[model samples]
Target: MRRGRDEQGQVSLLIIGFAGVIAMVIAVVVDASAAYLQRSGLDTLADGAALHGADLGATGEDVYTGGLPEERLALTEPAVRAAVGDYLRRVGAHRSYPGLTFTVAVDGAESVTVRISAPLDLPLRFPGSPADTTVSATGSAVSTVD
Candidate 1:
């Protein structure tokens, strides 16, 4: 009779432990999903910014002889950076993501690249896990004279 009573409480303890583990697992999954979605959004923003910068670079090029004389087209570093900054500002990306930070660079003479990063806040914090996670994304676009 004593052993039966002790075993009855053991199952209850096991159930409680299992429930706690399940809750932690759920928290982890939810946080991870949120981070993934944030990263995806950042990537899309970077791609759009990069494309806009590249288009600006293309427009800034001087077509010698109207697409003749080797079609002098070039993407300067300053121009690319300025274009990316303007695009971000115009699209209100900074306002949308308060923690967002980005960098723009001209990749070679014909391509522009943008790297975007943002921090994601987790609803639930687990032991040994960070409360905020940083997500980063990069995008590149090529300028074409024709």
Candidate 2:
């Protein structure tokens, strides 16, 4: 009739359960931190791409309006696209993750925008195809009339 011996097993079970919970919490913390870093990086990439594209567009407009009538729209669009693409690739979106996509568009003569998106796989939450998150930036610069 010794109650102390029986209580020892219960203590062990509780300890094991607490340890498992602690491990799970640590894993969650690490995963969340990594996701945050990835998100931040993507945001920077989007901003850079948009700004570069916009600069190109704005410059083209300035050149054309500054008595350069021979400059065609096709040349401007391609230059913007190439600049955006180069920025995106250098920023690791095209090389790092396969679930990322970029969309760049020329919005008129003085504006350009770039959209960057990625699908993140987050476990311990609703399970399914992860939701796609997108970050976009638009920049506009106008030519000053002399």
TM-score of each: 0.86, 0.61
- Candidate 1, 6-98: lDDT as tens digits: 456788899999999999999999988988888898898999999998888555545333452244357777777888889889988888778
Q: Identify the leading candidate in terms of TM-score.
A: 1
Provide the overall lDDT of each model, using Cα atoms, as 2-decimal numbers.
0.81, 0.62
Q: Give lDDT tens digits, candidate 2, residues 47-145.
A: 777777655544555465665434333225677778778767777666675667777676555456666776655545433323654333333323223
Residue 64's lDDT in candidate 1: 35
Superposed model 2: Cα runs more than 4 Å off: 1-5, 65-79, 90-92, 105-111, 119-146
Q: In order, what is each prediction's RMSD in angstroms? A: 2.7, 5.7
Q: What lDDT is obtained when candidate 2 is compared to the true structure?
A: 0.62
- For candidate 1, what is the total of clashing residue pairs? 0
Question: For all candidates, what are the clash counts?
Answer: 0, 0
Residue range with the least summed lDDT across 10 consecutive positions in model 1: 63-72
